[model samples]
Target: EDKVVQSPLSLVVHEGDTVTLNCSYEVTNFRSLLWYKQEKKAPTFLFMLTSSGIEKKSGRLSSILDKKELFSILNITATQTGDSAVYLCGAGGTSYGKLTFGQGTILTVHP
Candidate 1:
């Protein structure tokens, strides 16, 4: 069965602390790995890493993909209270945007 798993299911960090969220997966016909931030409602997109674009970065957030390892990592540098949210990782395959999501990593940034 295709699945994704994230480590450190929850985290608490002081302002300016750096944190890394881990996601590992097992799937067939893998196409891409996507990252999202969830606060309420549905998750919002953060990064999408494919064979052509294996690394993505935005501000203090960055993610890298390792197809061989079948996993990805999200790094947040200098986190702020505003950064507190649930981090979600998903795999995109031939299912046409159908995503297999990991149990999100909840992040709480204390000021």
Candidate 2:
């Protein structure tokens, strides 16, 4: 059975504060690690990390994978209230694309 864990289950920050989310996994036949952001209903895909030490970034969001450590980190800079959401990381493999998701880190950005 594959399992994923996320640190600091919840966070509260003011606008413009930076945040870092951590995810670690232990699974069989690991293929990829994916990051997503959920605001209201659906979780929006953020990044898919397959290679170690490679950082994926888009605007204020960026993530990196450490395959050797079986962990990943997500960073959000210059955060705004809109950045408040549940951040998720999923461990994916050949099991018909099924992913084991983390508990999720709830971020609250207040102005």
Candidate 3:
């Protein structure tokens, strides 16, 4: 069975603050680590990491996976109120469409 856990179930930050979200997992035949952000509607894709150490980025958001450690971290720098959302982490296995997800971390950014 695959299992994912995210730390600090919720966070409160002000604009311009930097935040790091943690995710740890134990997955059988792990293929990749996936990150998502959910606001008012459906969740939006953030990053998918297959290789360890290398970081992926988009604007102020970035993420890195550590395969050996079986963990990943999502970073948001200079956060804005618009950045407030529920961050979700998932572990992807060899099977497509099969993922074990963590109970998201809710980030509330204040102006």
lDDT of each: 0.91, 0.95, 0.96
Candidate whose lDDT is highest: 3
- What does candidate 3's lDDT look like per residue over 16-107, in tens digits? 99999999999988999999999999999999999999999999999999999999999999999999999999998898769999999999
Model 3 residue pairs with clashes: none
Q: Better model by lDDT, 1 or 3?
A: 3
For each candidate in turn, give its C-alpha RMSD to the true structure in angstroms: 1.3, 0.7, 0.6
Pairs with steric clashes in candidate 1: none
Model 3, residue 4: C-alpha shift (Å)? 0.2
TM-score of each model, in listed order: 0.95, 0.97, 0.98
After superposing candidate 2 on the true structure, give the runs of residues whose Cα lies further than 4 Å from its correct spot: none
Q: Is candidate 1 or candidate 2 better by lDDT?
A: 2
lDDT of 2 by residue, 59-90 (tens): 99999999899999999999999999999999
List candidate 1 stretches off by more than 4 Å: none
